[model samples]
Target: MTIAHSLGFPRIGKQRELKKAVEAYWRGKLNQEQLLAEGQKLRQQHWQWQAEAGLDYVPVGDFAWYDQVLNLSCTLGVIPERFLADAKQIPSEVGLELYFKMARGDTNEQGEVAACEMTKWFDTNYHYIVPEFTENQSFAISSSQLLEEIKEAAQQGLKPKPVLLGPLSYLWLGKAKGSDFNKLSLLDELIRVYGELLVKIADLGVEWIQLDEPILTLDLDNEWRQGFETAYNRLQSTPVNILLATYFGALGDNLGTAINLPTEGLHIDLVRAPEQLTSVVDRLPAYKVLSVGVVNGRNVWRTDLQQWLERLQPVKQRIGDRLWVGPSCSLLHSPVDLNQEQQFADDVRQWLAFAVQKNKEIAVLAKALAGDNSTEITAAIEASMAAFKEKNNSGRIHDETIQARVQAIDANMSIRQKPYNQRVVLQRQQLKLPLLPTTTIGSFPQTTAIRAARKAFKAGKLTEAEYRAEMKQQIADAVHRQETLDLDVLVHGEAERNDMVEYFGEQLSGFLFSQHGWVQSYGSRCVKPPIILGDIKREQPMTVEWIRYAQTLTNKPLKGMLTGPVTMLCWSFPREDVSREVSCLQLALALRDEVQDLEKAGIHIIQIDEPAIREGLPLRKAEWQQYLDWAVRCFKIASCGVENTTQIHTHMCYSEFNDIIEAIAALDADVITIETSRSDMELLDAFENFEYPNEIGPGVYDIHSPNIPSQDWIKQLLKKAANKIDLERLWVNPDCGLKTRDWSETEQALANMVAVAKELREEYQAS
Candidate 1:
């Protein structure tokens, strides 16, 4: 017999019930009890949905108020002493408030400590708070969220496999506090805490535990490699069966070390690197199970059932009943379900499967492998095959005219009109401005009024003319505000956009969207990425109307905002049948036309944001250059079509870019803005080492936090930035967009930012 299971489930809820409930609590609309009840309801809904799909084992501990890694950090009592000390006087029941404070800092009568720094989770777009460790750090089992969730799953009669981030990976993903110290030095104490947690799980009488150690797939040294051995070896005494899982890449040379662990099973991500299977099957131990992850959890494309069945048949024959089949990673990265995507057309809808449908596909595959070949199982396979065939030969998949243009592309389309040196000179002459030019990264806050108007328009409560008038007023207000603030460059405020990528996708051919298919970009931040199905083309002007209108209002020279091709493809779920390079090139071609149109509309400074380029890089160092080569090319193709004086700018956010400085230079935008405020000017070292020639805006304010920086603080950051960059090349801006921020804070923060820039200008003049 074969078993079907899930590594994890999406926590944002089907219709975004969790997001609404959480936001309501933050807004003081709901009490703590109300919010807890809502979270409980969402967890039950997700678990029952998976159980109904015939999964043998459903996962618990996947629900997070903010992030899963933060939950683990809090549960293990690895929180900083500052938060614990702050919570000493608070009531015991409100201890979870400390957890929330650690993830997103809160203020009271006492002094405030900022929230822990956040970074990209592995190579994915998901953000996790970095666990801070000190030399005297200690660990203990303090939180009961996991154990309580386990008991709750038992009440639902579902066999719960509580998922925990493996200790090795958790330690590897974190950083040391303030000073340089070996983070792995605290591994022993961390394993002790895990041992205690496992003992409790054993007491609950749970059968299997899923230990996610995704970092094992990365390059490891001798000490860190040996640390994995020591940690799991200590946990071998636990009664619960351990399923050590590795995903996002292959085990590669670590296969021997991984298989040799004294555990019940080892799960490998075959969806990413299928070639690792032969070696995994060969090294299988007789007494242990071998879980093969054949289904994709990150993408929305329907699994090729027949292809997966063929690959797993031989494995089932070898491993017999010990095999457990599931997604290659957690379903947390995917949308909730395909059935919720009612907005999709029939022709395109048949080719996609979200998180819920993927579970059913796994169940069907397990039955077929177990030789239970019922008519239902046979029909599922046949339908999947038909969907694949229809999607392959669809007339919408290609455009001969677009293909011809792409093929005829030469050196001219990929290169700017002038190199950085010549272009900067021409840009300065064309747009006379101050030394420290200030601008926002293309968007202002999307207020409740804007969201309500968009909702009304979608629901037919308002006419098209009414919607246009309202959004235009919002843009006019944005222009007026920028003039009041006296900023150098202005944006159209993007009030008409539901999202940057999705808005452009709505104007282009070959993309589909959902009313409620929201995925978490970070804490309380959700994005609905359009699904790219066929060949892409700009049917008409996407940004010209709003940008042209805003340009009329501001003599500050409006910066035409657009999401770059690489970011669009990286953010959206591209078709499974196409290579990313091909899909990206098609997107680039579509944007090339948009770029030319925006220029013709009298927009001088166009900002094409590519924050996802670093997120889309391959995990392995050996494969970075291959992916970056095309990614840079795609960005260039999208932004390089205009003249030198057009002044193209790009923005990157919330990433460690030390490794990709050359690729950053390769995009060759006339100006670039990066998120450096959170890291305290350390990110400038990359630009300093590269001696980056183009103008730069090292963001002076950390946009992610509501805690505004003082003018003195901002000036200090600028002083540090001056050491690395030339005075003429420096610009002033916030780290990213202010969409999530409210009007009051946005005004206060930008006011502080402008004052900081003026003070810096005074210093430059006196010198």
Candidate 2:
């Protein structure tokens, strides 16, 4: 019989209980015991759901209080030295505190420590804590969380399969901190820890272990490939049967090395690269189990079960009992449950499936493949087929006017009227500014009163007029604050907007909102993304009124803020029926209309953020240009409609631009601000090497951490940035928006930021 299992499940509860509990713990409302209990409850509930779905084995060790990668870091004793005074001490005593501190920095008698740098997980919106490594890194089995979880699952009478981040991928995902050296050089020591970890899981009576190595989808050199072989060969000696899992994209060249690894099974993602199925089966050993992921894991779209069964039939025939079925990747990228969305249209809701539904789909696929022709199984297959067909042909999803507008897009629409050199001159003449001009990334802190008023307004406790007054008051306060700081530029503070993307989606047509569809973007930070069900088009100006009001309040140039087309698409659950290029172009045209309106509204500066553009790059190097070409075109379409006097700015956070510096330059915004404080100004080397023509704001403060950077510290960072790029074209800003920060931290940080700019300006003039 074919096995049915999952790579992982969404740990955030259906109503986001984990988010609430974690936040409560951080705020001192909940104690450590209560937090651990809450975590256990969530883990048990998720495991029960998987068991109920008829999974052959319930996956343990997938649950985390913050992130799975950070959990693994603690499990393998990879805590950074800053968090621990003594390197020899065991971390488990202060495990939870150490973990939270590593994720969100801490300030104590030991002064302040910055958190470990974070970045996107592959092509997904999920953020993982990037592991920190040094040349002399050592590993040991520290945290007993995974071993304890396996026992808990076994006690529940469910067959448990422990999941772990593969050793090779863990090293590959990390950075070399203090001294530069090959991370792979430390793999022998890392595998020794993994060998011990596997033995512990085996002693817990676990029969199978799923080790995820998603980096196989990326281009790798011979040494990294050889490291995988050596690591797994050492790990294969453990009693537990190993299932090597790869997802996000096709294995391609790595397929040979992956299959040849001394493991009992291999999992391939057929939803992304189904063509690899035949090739994988042809070369696989007959004794090894081949788990084929047929259901979509990264998306909410329902799988066409009938079609998938047809595709899997021949593969099953070749592999017979060795064939297994699951999702394309971990369902951590998906929302918890589709059943919680009570507000969605019936037709639209039918076309969707969350993590819970996806697991049931996996079970149904496995049963059908095993020739279980029961009435219930047949009905599920039929329902899935019907949903897929209706979604494709639904008149609600297609709009002729929007389609025509997208089709009418021309190359001229994607080019600016003037290049950066000419445009900067016009912008400077139009709005005179000083060297190292200080600005923000277009949002002030969203405070408790602000959140309360918005909640009250949404709940109908306040009228539209009353709500507008409250938001206007907040915006005026923000303007006064910026004027007080003596910053060069100002922003409307985005007091009226709930989220950068969701705010725009609410005004646009052809999108669906969810009441309880939240996914974790990073630790304790959950985002409820809008569902893109149909063609996208803007009916009216989204940010004009708020921006115009703020501009009137301040003598300084206030930026008109808008989320870019690529970010709006990549961050949301985009339409599967249309090509991304078509959907993105449609969004670009809509945003283009808004950009022109902002120009007309007397706004001199506009910032359209494309943070997800780098996140949207294809995993395979050979396929990157096709994605970059369309992504750049869409951004240009949104931004290129403005005049040279109207300075266009863009912001990106927590993304590595070294490989895509040319594409970043091609966006052609007059100024670009990025998150560089966490990486300690390392990202500036890319812009400096490329001799990027436009102005830039290499962020001087890390807003994600609550630690207020001192004035001298900000000045030193500015000095580092000045050495790399010309100070003439440099701007000063924070790493990202201050939406998640409190007002006190925001005020102190901006005060220091403005001080750094002023001091730098006077010093440069004197020199």
Candidate 3:
């Protein structure tokens, strides 16, 4: 029988119980035992769900409390000196916190510790905290989370594929602290660590390991080319069969290198890079098992099984007995299951397939190829065909009117009503701001009461009027607090939004909201991205009521916040039928109308966040411009229609803006805010060197932590930023929004931020 396997499962629970439980543990509300129990429960439930969906090889060790890359760093004992020094007796909980801090800088009572820098994970918005290594990086294989998970799955009579980050991908993704990338000669030692890990798993009686070397999809040099063969050759004697899984893009030049390696099995992503199959089939070694990634992992569209079957035919002809079927990558990018979406209209639902549906597709494909001519499989494929045809014929897509408007948006249309030089004078004059303006990043804490009220309204427990009254009261109080604190700019505090992207997705056409589709963004933080179902169009104004109402209560310049088209399209599970550029353009057109409406409502300043813009760039440098061109064009289309006096701002979080400064500057916002607190204003160097001709707010504080930032800290950051950009054009704010923080921290942090700005202003005047 042809077997089906998964590279990994979504670690986030269906209801996001893992996020809540982890947060509870961090806050001392829940103990370690409780955290562990919750994790185990989630893993068991996930395994059972996949098994029920007919997945033959459910994966273990893919589940992580924080991140899989961080887990591998721990597994290899590559703990950086800083984390090791600060953590005297680090439990896994504290270890996890330190890990996240490395990925996204942290500020607590201990002061600021830079987050481990993050990098793109194969063109996905999902970020892995880059592992920091040193020449002295050692091996410590103490964590048995994988072993325990495998044992648990076996206890339930499920034999599982133990997933691990392959040695080459792990080392390639890491950097050595205070050392140049070229100087780190740790490959030999790193291979030893993996050799040790493989032997240990062999001792645990695991039969197969899904060792992910997704970097095999990228362009590589001789060093990485040499490392692959050297490491696997050393592990050839290990008892476990290593399945080297590569995904996210094509294996152009890397295919020959990969097939030449002495691994037992190879998994190729035919979904994204299907063109490479002609070469992949020709080059595979007779003994090497091939797992064809036929089903799409990153998209939500239902699979066309007939098309998939045709592709699988040639592969089956060559290696029919040895072939297996799987998803292009981990199903983590997709939602957990379509079974939970009870509210979707059947027609819309027919066109959709979540992670669970994708898994079943793989199983059915595997069985059909194995000569099981089940009537259900054929009928399901026919139904998918019918749905595809219906979607094509609906006239919902291909809007000539929208395309004409988009094509009409030329250089003049993209340019704001006023250029920066003029807009600067206009904005400073209109707002009557200081040299360095003080503001928050558009949201205050979303309190339990606010969440409860929103939930009550959604569940029909509270009337719309009651919900609105409470939300208005919350907004009024937030505005009053900012007023008392003497903040120059005001926001509605985003009390009405469950999430930045989801709130807009719920209102916009061509999108579908998931009731239980949740994924962990970071430590204990969850996001449910709206699913793009069809051509996107805005029926009416989405944020007008909230922004207009907030403006009524405040004389200050109220910044209307919207998620940019690129971010909305990037974050959501987009449809496979449409190109991302097309989807973004559709979202851009919808948001353009909203921008016009916000301006009409007399909102002078608007902040459209494109945090995921960098994530959407192509992995290869050569292909980056094409993506960035469309990305910037989409942003311009979304924001350029407003008047010159209307200041447009954009924000990016946890980004290293140096490499892409030119492209970012090309976006041409009047002012931009970015997360700089983590890097201690290291990101500002780009602006300084490039002489970026726009205003900026390098974040003065990190918002991810519970502890407040000191006035001294904010002062230091501002002083650093002032050296980089003109103090006249600089603004002071936190690295990002404060929605995740508690009331005490948010109030204290903002107060300190304002205090720093005031101190800087006094010094400028005195000088």
Candidate 4:
């Protein structure tokens, strides 16, 4: 019988129990023991759920209180300098405080910490804690989390296949505090620790361990090849059957190196990079069991069993007896079970499948290969094929009028209405701003009280009218506070929104909001991404009421905040039936109307953020331009309809900007704000090199932390920014929105920000 395995499961639980419990603990409502008990119960339930789904190899150690990478950091003693316990004598006690500190970070009673530096997890929206390395970095599997999980699963009569981030990926994704990218000296020590971890798991009688080496998908040179060899060699002594897994892209020449790595099993994602099947067949070791990732993992598309079988036939001929079929990667990205969606149109919902339904896809493909002709499986596969035909080439895809309009747009559409010179003259005169204007990235702190109110409103304790009144009050107060602070710009504080994407998704057509769909975007922070079910259109204005109302409250330039079309499309669970560009354009046309509405509302300085722009880039460099072209076009379409002096501003959260500077410029925003404090203004280097002409705000302080920055620190940042760009074009602000912070910090930070901006204005004028 073929074995079915999952690389991991969503840890947030079906109803987001973990998120509730963790937040409860942070609020002092739950104790450490209560938190641990909740975690254990969640893990047990997940294991049972996977087992009931008929998985042969259920996963363990994948559920984490914060992040699995942070857990590994704790186990390996790679704790950053600040999180390290000061006394050192009670090193064993450091586990609890250190882990939370690494995640939430230690701050005053106001909630601050030395914020953890977060980075992208292998091209997905999910973030992992970037491992901090020191010369004194030590390794020990201190926690019994993994072993306990395996033992618990065994008690439940399930054989668990534990998943681990392979040493190569772990080390490759890490950074030394102040070292060059070429630093490979830490690799040797990191691998030694990983080898010991393998030994520990083997000692616990764990037979199959899934070692995910996703770095195989990246552009690798000779150095990475040697690093892989050294790492796997040290880990080879363990009796555990290593299932070496690679996903997200094609293996190419890395296939030969992977096949020779002395692993007992090799897993390749035939669903993502299906061209790798030819290579997998050409280079299989005699004793190796091949786990073919045949089902779609990253997409919402259902598998065409007939097409999958065509790709599998050649591989099955060589290794049929030793073959296993599964999802191309973990089903964590896909929503929970499709059976839970009751509100969707029956026709559309019938054509969809979530994680639970996907398991059936894998199982049916396995049985079909084994020659089991069950009617249910056959009917399901047939329906999927029928749906694919209906949806892909459906009448819903193209609008002749929309297409004509898009085609009619010339290069001038991408250019602003009037040149920057004329627009700035009007904007400055209208706004009457001094040098070094101060503004925020368009959110105030989302406090516990506000969260409770929203949660209450969601549960129907508060009516729609009541909720709006409450949110309006919060917005009114936020605008009132900003005016009192004498800030140059103001925002509505966005207390009305639960999420940047979900807020707009609620008002848009063709999207479904889940009652219980929660996925971890990072440590302790979960997002409920809206699923696009069919053709999308705007039913009504999304942010107009909030923006117009907030504008009524303030005399200052109240910026109308909206999430751009490309971001709304990228951040949501997009429709797989059509090309992404088509879906993006659909959203762009809708937002274009909204932008015009906001301008009509008499709101100036409209900020449309595209934080996911970098996250949406294709994994391969050769294909990046195709994505960038459509992405920039979508953004331009959204912003172009507004008149000159409207002052469109775009904000991007933490990302590497050097590679896409030209594309960023193409967005043609009057101003752009980007996270720069964490990178030490290195992000601005791209603008300097590209000779970017637009005004810019390289964040003066890191918003990811609670560390209250002094006025001097902000001044220093402004001074450094002034050195690179013209001082007249600089704006001062934090790296991101202040939603995750407390009111005290938010108030103090802005007050300090304004002070620093004032000082800069005086100094620049004198110079």
- Put down candidate 3 lDDT per residue, 1-767, tens digits, no spaces: 78888888788887778878877877789887878899999999989888987888889988888778887776666666665555443344334555555544655556666566654465776767778775555656636566677889888888788898888888778766675554226777777767777787777777788899998988898777877888888878777899999998888888878998888899999988889888987889999899989888887788888888887877787797789999999987877888899988787778788888888888888887887778987777778789888877866556676667656666765667766888778777777877788888888988999989998998999999999999999999899999988998988898888898998988887777889877656656677888887677788899999889999997889999999999999899887776899889888889989999999999999999998888887766778889999999999989999877889999998765588999999888998999887667878888878989989988888787555778887888889988888888899889899898888778888889898898889999899
Better of 1 and 3 by TM-score: 1
How well does candidate 3 score on lDDT at residue 386? 92
Candidate No. with top lDDT:
2
Clashing residue pairs in candidate 2 (N, C-alpha, C atoms within 3 angstroms): none
TM-scores for every predicted model: 0.97, 0.98, 0.94, 0.93
Sequence-dependent TM-score of model 4: 0.93
Candidate numbers, best lDDT first, in rank order: 2, 1, 3, 4
Displacement of residue 80 (Cα, Å) in model 4 is 1.4
lDDT of 2 by residue, 229-265 (tens): 9998899899999999999989999999999999999
Better of 2 and 4 by TM-score: 2
- RMSD, each candidate, Å? 1.8, 1.3, 2.5, 2.9
| Model 4 regions lying over 4 Å from their true place | 87-94, 108-113, 135-138, 374-409, 419-422, 447-467, 688-690, 706-719, 763-767
lDDT of 4 at 392: 70
Pick the TM-score winner. 2
Q: Write the per-residue lDDT of candidate 1 for residues 592-636, one digit (tens) a residue.
A: 888899999998899999998899899888899999999999999
Candidate 4, 264-346: lDDT as tens digits: 88888876687778778778888998888877776555677777766676667777767888888877777666677787665
Please give the lDDT score for candidate 2.
0.90
